[model samples]
Target: MLTNGLEKRTLSDVDVRDAFFDELYRLAVEDRNVIFMTADMGAFSLERFKRDFPKQYFNVGVAEQNMVSVAAGLALAGKKVFIYSIVPFVTLRCLEQIKIDLCGMNLPVTVVGIGAGVMYGGDGPTHHALHDIAVMRALPGMTIYNPSDALLTQASVRLAYEQAGPVYIRLEKGCLPVLYEDAGGGFQQGFTQLRAGKDISIMATGLMVHHAVTAKDILSRVGLSVGIFDIYRLKPLNEQALLEVMIHSPRVVSLEENSRIGGLGTALSELCADAGCRVPLMRMAWPDGHCREACGREEIHRHYRMDARSVAERILDWVRNT
Candidate 1:
């Protein structure tokens, strides 16, 4: 079993899933009303969850729709419900239930989707979650959290429990090097500036935040002053804070693993247009298409010019032109 002592270990080896479930199991122990529902996507930590909280845990087979409905029912019955499944299955397949049963009623149900973006890699388009943010964001009253590392993931789980309405926490599959020691007040503020610079600001979510940080280092070597912002909260975006940051930098680049349309890029663009912020913006994301088979996350990112080197080059080009 994972322990709180994990906080003392090297943060670079932390996995978001482990940190999330560890905190979840702790919460369940503290709150009898907490319940966990899964649509047949099993995890190593879940085995212990089932063994310890058998009465509160349910595996609804592969029925994503039923899983969501059941979670909504449990919430209405006074349970702090958490639903888990693969991203496309939980969000896209059960979008109707999520819309009507959860968001429509404004219940406190946390839907945790694993494998955000192309983390499914070889699983192809069916497993990719490029459109999850776009589709889910359209649903009214759904708060979205796309954490970049274990620290933020654990914090988001706690926030999910505290929130009253429907929340969607998107997570990438497998282990990832840690991005932050503490997301600090950033989780509450919706965004945090990881590195400060005057040339441009790179706003990124999920795995892209790590890439953007690396790109910042690369640009720094060439005397380019670039800033990095890690955005964990998508909806209910901190427009005032974002505007404050962007106002200092003349240019802003949004980097995300999802599609360029309707994800972070689109959200930020709309924020700029509506707020009438005059900062020139650029977005780096996957083109509207399916990732070919035999491609891993890095391969796909490289192909789309979203890798650190490529992103740095793109920023340089944009800076030169603009």
Candidate 2:
């Protein structure tokens, strides 16, 4: 039961990338066995890593597949390895390496992919990782996390470092809206309910968490009580929490920045069926396709009908009809 009353802070306010590197530096300092690998993209942050811990840093120079394989090999030798790169290049380009070398072998490698979803909005379709979730979720024994803000991002990085297994962490490009102030020291690797309501449940992830929060406010102004769930861990979802929320609300709306297929909606639907819960489910996400050109994040969201206004309208329509 997390409440959202803290002042909204942008990603820049928290130095998310620095926090990630700071944790890595701390871990590497303590554990001489830890190693960091990158596909030549972490120039600014990796500099400190290279200077402070030169022996533990490896720059793979654009070869994401080779980087992942090397990290897998290192992890197999009891070395805590982390692979960093942009979202598309890291996830899609190295899909085979990730699936075979890391996930298939059950290696404890932390694969950090920046610019998840449309975070690289103006960078065009080539850079947008619209299908990264679908791809990463298909891998077995892989832990997937999409942190809502800098705080959660730092927490996820720390957890990935501590946990043993192949982990995929999707990070937004820059600063995002801070939705949670104190997750009570830290949040667990599962969904956290941000707001509680009996009429509707809004299950959201990634950047959409902010939108869900905004939508909740808008819906509430209209005398609608909406429950909000921040789905931190995509795989190994908090089934019990989800079931309880759905059972209590009777109407669930899943919001995500990725496609409807194989994303939050798919997971929630499966959870409902598995729990034998009957509810009217609505999915708010990108359509079952790709975009043509580059656009701003807000424009893309509105074009796809995933903006706060659109979500609010959808929920209002559903409530009225019901």
Candidate 3:
């Protein structure tokens, strides 16, 4: 079955991690100045990097803070450094180092965070990165990029390497559905509207983009035209594009896997208020507290009411009430 004329795919069907690793390896091969560092994770992937460029790969066992600092040091010495680790361990655990060492120095270091936003669903709260966006977005000069699928993840890796500054990219453990067949649709450092509509606008980021697209389809089938925007860059938000969309639709909904506070919803709300555009705004996200148990990704998603069905029902209810 298809929702909103958009078909669904799973990570097992796509090769996101491999695609990202391949791109990283390609860059390392060409540029001797490129270095890969992982905090005891990504053994198989780092093995490939070490096999090709042994001198350029470093496995700093379980030291995310030290890893970020070391990457910043290397970047200062004119080296393109990429640090890879699990989301919570790398982003939250090393927040101070990321801010002080990387962002403070304005170094070109790419910190790749895996298991973003409960991708490691069965791993429990310690592993889930529900607040990485809010934490990373608060850091000055840090570019936060969240790719919806493997293709965009690869493109984001390439862009992070080329962009000058501290870049934080959130990646899943494996492949996700290919939202865009090619990156030629302009996956810039801002939000991009994936589908256009006239009734409501759905702003989403990370894995939620897939669900947002699904929700769009569900609404469209009921004769409700909805627009969907993939928020790739969260920190330096594309204010103009977001405002234009809000103005066009007048009703807006933001869907994210992270907490409602200080996430896409918060950012969009602020943007709308600043632009003096008042419309019906809704947010579908995790509540302010932490989840207690370790469960499957889909189970957790349903528990938080973040699935496509819940999103569609909520939007439809909102439309009906409004």
Candidate 4:
């Protein structure tokens, strides 16, 4: 999976924390002012960050609110701070602090939220981050990046480091199969067209991206042309590119691991409406409900009928009826 001579590309497992932490460690080594704060959620591979950069690393002992406040203070003092924690704790738990301390002041703080969507499926609704995208996108001056693989995760980390405003890095909890051999250098364009088709456009992010690709193949076998849009960046959407892609198909479907309310589906709908594109938009997301069943991510996806086979079947049915 090493594409473009990258040291590491594809991962066989579902854990992406190591890849992110490795990139953070590299940035911390080069920039002494790069500080890392966590709310006691880095159990997989945070020891290296603490051991190597003792002065720059801190554990806030599960206090997400205080962690954000402290990070804001550090950013004000001319320090580049990176906050890491579970999706809910960092985003929903400390929403107020993030709005005022980071977004209001336009500070250059990188908030990395692990366990995006239902990657923590068995952990129940409390660990699920279904509404993170909607909540974070509402904030002013916040850039969102939800990478599909380890390669994109590295690029997102670099972008977060270079940018001068609040940025949210939404990462899936488990190790995901490396989908793109290359991210075309980086996620500067906000989205990338993986496979082109004339029937419908499937826009997906994070873990759903791989499923979108699978759905494309499945639809292709039935003589249906399917196009895939890997939307890693949510907010500050690449409107121009999305419009161009929508031109390929009249029916566009937004697939995400988040809620149907304010996730990628909403963003694309708003973009299409603004551009006056007359394409029919459909969103396949978790409905308004909590995940009461404790199961794996794939099981949850199957239950919601968001799996590759289910998605392709639904599209086929819609095409036939319409």
Candidate 5:
């Protein structure tokens, strides 16, 4: 939703890109050392940065690898740099640059990648960022953020700028409803419990958070008040706290748009193993493969049996038949 001063706006009114730049612009205003550079990606609020804060805006054409290297140099020069690009381009394409230039020195450069998961569902697998989380989490000292709403995106900007290491912010496009009333100090914990339930808990991140909340309501019709945990911060997850939440439920499901291999599911799985928790865990994520069929996210989700209905039905079967 479009934010006007402090007045609350509906969730549908804010675009992730616009909310991001809007918040970063505020930071740039206060700190002239803050800069934004991109690899010729989409221009949501870029024009504003160019027109009003020209000195802090940079457009590095289509050379993504070079852009990361440049941002590393800027960081070395005592500047807080943010490189905006599509998911694959910013991380996968320039993995070496990010690893050697930014991560090598633990620079304070924030890489903002748009189109989290299948946000560009119609754009085919080439645009899908199914492996982005796994790729990013592997970078040494890199912090990953997958925001579920505009409020978190704004908070993420501040957190990324304030932190000392390289940070990656994953975002989804389109009109997503607001999931947070306000992002306060607790955001630093890296996760939030949306609701509590006795039977099962759906630990979701990014856009799937909406599906989790909807699935919670859907399950309620069948007399199940499912728990919800939004794990926005992927890496450096608060494992002990998350385990505390999971131990209360008989089953826990890690929900996300990325692949189950090395995404949220895998992370949670590792946590359970290390903590010696025996609660049953299920992974709800994009199937490990590519789809050529051009479609919207909901349609693709339905085709893959990953929609809200599927999520509810699956949990229903687990709760009733298991």
Candidate 6:
């Protein structure tokens, strides 16, 4: 399939969604108290859980707001619950429920948002989850995990189970090349240094980490050594470590598919400001506008100059100009 002259990339051949649910399935098997609830989204991962543990599995039938409150109630009953739905609906539509029932009460419920950012391209702005991070992160006691690969995604399921308060997992639908051999080492720091460079550091979350990798390779050939920091944990990020790493580079760039208003860039900016550190920052994000593009994800990214070549050139321009 082609959209806007760019071949449509397969959304999730080796999907991280499966990895997340598979982990949940395993956990459910071991602990029947682990529950999986959804707002009518179906996947291969749901079959066994629904069949074997019917009581633990629920389909809320498109009622995302109700699902969140339901999840909170379940969590209050000493069950670790995960509420699933599309990125925007599960987060935006049920913002009140999540804010009050989950975060405000601080329950051990995982809000799994599928198709992070513009992955639901052609689904229109209504489906785009641009503000999930900003909104969820702002809520007190909300832990946000935006994993870039299947390994870390599975790890996030475990993290959600282990953590005490409300957790939000931002997931990408499509395939992300396996980046980590194992989910260990720097996993607890809430970020992973994918590659190290001195000239610039690209702080990216979710699948945008892959884009940062592409941009890193492009910049490498131009004699620019760029670091790629996969910031999986948006909230409760290891501030001292991230600040130290960001200062190592002359410039820091934040890349994400979400809206620029209060996403990754804003988080980094907050970190810098609170620390009284002064370093040039660039935010590569979806601009402030209603995105009406029906093109595929990559094509939409290309249109917004978020692809590798554009990001590389933009970085080079910034390096040259100031």
lDDT score for candidate 1 against the true structure: 0.88
Q: Candidate 1: list runs displaced more than 4 Å.
A: 1-5
Instruction: Please report, in order, the local distance difference test score of every candidate based on alpha carbons.
Output: 0.88, 0.81, 0.84, 0.86, 0.87, 0.86
- TM for every model, in the order presented, reads 0.96, 0.92, 0.93, 0.95, 0.96, 0.94
RMSD of 1: 1.9
Task: List runs of model 3 lying over 4 Å from the truth.
Answer: 1-13
- Cα lDDT for residue 71, model 2? 92
Candidate 1 lDDT, 218-316, residue by residue in tens: 999888998899888998898999988888787999999898889999998898898888899998988888877568878877878888999999999
Candidate 5 is scored at a TM of: 0.96
lDDT of candidate 1 at residue 80, scale 0 to 100 = 96
Give the per-residue lDDT digits (tens) of candidate 5, residues 12-128. 587766777788888988999999998988666667777888889888999999999999999999999999888988889999999999999999999999989887889989888
Local error of candidate 4 at 149, Å? 0.4
User: Could you give the C-alpha RMSD of every candidate to the true structure, in order shown?
Assistant: 1.9, 3.4, 4.3, 1.9, 1.8, 5.7
Winner on TM-score (3 vs 4): 4
- The C-alpha local distance difference test score for the whole of candidate 4 amounts to 0.86
Ranking by TM-score, best first?
1, 5, 4, 6, 3, 2
Each prediction's total of clashing residue pairs, residues at least 3 apart in sequence or on different chains, is: 0, 1, 1, 5, 4, 1
On lDDT, the stronger of 2 and 4 is 4
Residue 93's lDDT within candidate 5 is: 94
Q: List runs of model 5 lying over 4 Å from the truth.
A: 1-6
The model with the greater TM-score, 1 or 4, is: 1
| Top lDDT model | 1
Residue lDDT tens for model 2, 1-322: 3122222344346655665676678778889888998898874556778998888998889899899998988998899998989988989898999999998888889888887677777777887877888788888988899988776777777788877789998876455666666646567748888888888889999888888989989998999988889998998787887787788887899998887788878888988888888899998777777765578878878877788888899889988987
